[model samples]
Target chain A: MGIIKLCGMAGLIITGWLVGFKKSADLRFRVQRLKKLYEETEELLHRLQYEGLERDRLLLSSFSDFCLVWNGKILFNESGLTAEDAVILKEMIQKLGTGNLETEEKRLLYVLERLRQQESAAQKIAVTNGKIYQTLGTCAGIMICIFLL
Target chain B: MKEDALDAVLPFVHQSIGRVFLFLPEETKREVCELRLRRNLPVCLTLPQGIRYLFKDGTIDDRPREGVLICTAEQLEETFFLLCKRSVYAHAEELREGYLSLPNGCRAGVCGRVAPDGMVRDITSLNLRIARAVEGCADSVVSAEDGGGILIAGPPSSGKTTVLRDTVRQLSKNKRVVVIDSRGEISGGTERPLSLGVNTDVLLIRNKAKGTEMALRTMFPQTIALDETGTAEELKGVEESFHAGVQIVTTAHIGEKRELLERKITRHLLASGAISTVALLSGKIGEPPEIFSPEEL
Candidate 1:
């Protein structure tokens, strides 16, 4: 009975650790997603500046790995984006092909700058909050085990 | 061909507008020549008979009435972007020229404020011109014996491009033809382009002079065909090709023969001895064009 109890305690602690690790990983994943989005946006700007590809072809070629779904206006399935980030992206897309070269480049640069800020903020949170969540999850499991013992 | 035109244009409009058009009666859809969308104005369809206002339910009337579909600024903007395939920067040249050439030979005439940088901004309206191909339309124009240049003249919407397309298609079958499709209208577009012929080469260059030069140097074309050649630069290109002994088939936006002298380009074109036959089309669509020799003008 004691062995089974110890095993249960160990199992609970591991499940807690796994949950905390998943949360920490999610924060890191969000940051990675933002970085990927930034790289994609940079490529998009380059194509717009030099390639002059049409909208549909441009998106198809540029965002093949972006996991995006464009329905004429809004872009859906933009994973790992916050509501604020989504709004910003939506605005960028709305004005995507509506301006001249200079204007378009300026707009994209502006959006990229904003996204960079968002990414930096996300990175900071991932560093601080990520560790906090993991520590809290592990401590909670230990406290429960101690109370049971 | 009417169905083809609709197919070309319908995809570039707003979803709501496209839905309305899809439900339109076949007869109404067939007669459509141009789809006009103006900011805050009732949607208008230019039919062969006359202009007609569109209702929300896909019905049409001579005058704007209640429930008539109003083309909001958003719709106009969306249509503009869609027509440009969502990349205005890619079509910057065409946008500056106040038009966008769509697939299937259709064209969107854009009206907008011009920025100091020569870019069009604050778009207010879009005129979507439907492209239709009438087979054998150029049969009378393309003569087997005549190896000389031919010039087609007509007013807007008088089927000048249609006839020119047929001329290119028919000529290309027998001879090495190059189409200086500056606007992408002649050969539909670079992607999913319309059939010109087996021996046809398309140059999507905006500058006719440059296109003609490149064609002469590389393509070794027997004939060079272009549409809506009015600019002095285009005239210069034609002159060069004429001197090179390459036949030219092109079109001008002149309604009547009298306008030929009024326009400096037409005057120079007629006197240059480059164009042999001038086919004048009446304002009516599908009417037989009146053909005359350059001397007859």
Candidate 2:
């Protein structure tokens, strides 16, 4: 009777161990999938931004007036744009119309630089979220093992 | 004279002369007259203010300065009409009918009241195009010549005629330049040219005519210079000139070199080896002209 009880307890321990290992493996797979999705979304966003910049450049070169009006409307509609940014954009459009092409191009480069900074901040947030998700998955797996034991 | 008298006379002068130079003070009038005469503009006779009543009934019989008014199209149909009753010979109509050249080589530009066949006859509205003759405008074309037909292309107000005139001046230095002055804009010669080269011969086809025929037969110029060539027949005239071994220089309304090539007449001229070089004038007068050659393409 004593040996049988001891085997039964060992069998329960082994089953719990296997379940935790499976949960960890499942989480690892899920994390890999999430990472892939995030990468694709990030790449798509980058491409969108690149295309936007190119469009802005071409518009500025050909129809500077249209570009000014369009940029004003975009900045006004976008919630993330600050009052300072709006002012800068207005001044940039004015300068672009009255000043040389080189000056206008420099202003566009400045806008690209600001966009890059925003993108970097977003990347940092994404990385933090990824780590948090990984930690939560591990903790959940450990808790499942404890409960089963 | 009375202020009302001066007021009454001012509109007549504006209508008859297409400009109101008499309203200016003596010193100002002297300066204006000198400038106009120097530029070969039609001379206006100074009139007493009382003569205003004579022009009121459309009776151009009462001679003020010059019997004709040299006002812009805007002035004649609008503010100036209140001063005089409508006459049978509306100066604006005469302009649209394609006669009556204004001083300064400007023909009164007319619009409104098109004929059923889409002809712009009977102009109810007028815009007096102020044509200023800029000497030495065609100087660039003379130096860059390779003895082929030349085209002066530009958007409106980009000084196409000014460049063509200067070219005539330069071409006249060596070659005899026969100018087909369709609108009198090129030479600004009312009866005769006030200023241009001594050697340059001008055939004032003052109103619209067949440019190529006019150039070939009447003028028979060794090198022909004219403004705004647009028709296939005109292109044929140019081809005829080429066949006759006469060099031609003319202006056309266009923006780019590619556009010139795309135009039927210009393209024909290019493809047929009639035009060897095209000088593209970019920008207005007073600014240094930018000349584009075919090699620069």
Candidate 3:
């Protein structure tokens, strides 16, 4: 019975830590994806600068595809963003669609910097709090085991 | 091309506008020369026949005020943004001229407030002048025997650039032609070169005078072409190139050779034997371009 209780405790603690780490990894992936999208926009602007705007709209439409893919179900509400994060993301996309490259670049750099900060924060929370959660889960299981005994 | 003509602005405007444009009978899209938009005004299309308003039901009216939808600020902003590729800084130099030459050979003439510093600060209206390239329009000019050079004369929107472009393409088949594209209108866009025949080079330079000198000095082109030459500087450049034994083809905003002769620099150019032929063109909508030589005049 003691062995059974120990195994249960180990499972709960490990699951808690793994879940936390997975959430952080997901956030990091979103940040990387967003940064790549930003680079695509930068290249579009660079082309627009030297080559000129095409009337067929091929370039802008291509960018729209990226936007659609980004907003697709896979990314929807999965970045673990808080309310503040959602607002920022919405504002950034709105500005990106506006077509002002200089402003877009500045805002993108700021966004990237912010995302990096958020990623670090998420990672810190994932690692530090994950350990805390694991420890708490183990303690709870131990206490329950004691009670059972 | 007609189907995707408004690609740059499609993302920003409502679907209603796109539907109206897309639903435009294929015949009408080909006939229309411009898509005019103004703040708080109905979208007006400049057809070969005349100016008309577009309705949401895919019908057009000559009334001009019967628009079902208005041109919104968002649409205009997006158009401007996309036109400049969202890089306002890089386009600042060209924006001061009150017009943007897009890649599809369309010219968007903008009207708006001007800052004291001379940059076009705010835009109120945009007239997208659509270009229709009639492939064989320059046949007469190309087949002419004169090796001296040809000057094309026409009023504004009289398709001078179209004729010049075709002429260059045809002449470039054999001659080493160099087109000094002051505006992207001639070559379509810098990145995507239009098919300017087999042996031709296009130099994208906004200043006509500077472009002429640049072409003469470096290109060693058998023929040099410039568009809309009325200034003294352009005349001098053309004269110098002509004297250097490089044939010059160019255009001017004039109704006839008499008007061109009345001009100070052109009179001198003609007298000096630099310009051999003055080809006057008057092309009506849906009609073949009628070219008249000096003898016809």
Native contact fraction, candidates in order:
0.91, 0.00, 0.12
Q: Positional deviation of A28 in candidate 2, in angstroms? A: 99
Q: Candidate 3: where are CA atoms >4 Å away?
A: A1-6, A9-83, A97-131, B1-14, B65-69, B82-90, B116-121, B190-193, B230-232, B255-257, B268-272, B283-297
Cα lDDT tens digits, model 1, B162-194, are: 899999889988899999988888888876677
**Mind giving the per-residue lDDT tens digits that candidate 1 earns over A58-89?**
77777665545466544455677778877877
TM-score of model number 3: 0.76
Candidate topping DockQ:
1
Runs of candidate 2 exceeding 4 Å displacement:
A1-149, B1-75, B78-100, B115-124, B192-194, B206-211, B214-220, B295-297
Candidates sorted on lDDT, descending: 1, 3, 2
Ranking according to DockQ, highest score first: 1, 3, 2
**Lowest-scoring 10 consecutive residues by lDDT in candidate 1 chain B?**
B1-10
With candidate 1 superimposed using the best TM-score fit, by how many Å does residue B61's alpha carbon deviate from the native? 3.9
lDDT for position B16 in model 2: 44
Residue-level error in angstroms, candidate 1, position A121: 3.0
lDDT by residue for model 2 over A1-149, one digit each (tens)? 87885676666556655655554554454434334333433432343334323223433343342233353232222223335434544553333322122333455566555545544554564466556655665566556556755
Give the top-scoring candidate (lDDT): 1
Interface RMSD of each: 1.2, 23.8, 5.3
Provide DockQ values for all models, in the order shown: 0.73, 0.00, 0.15
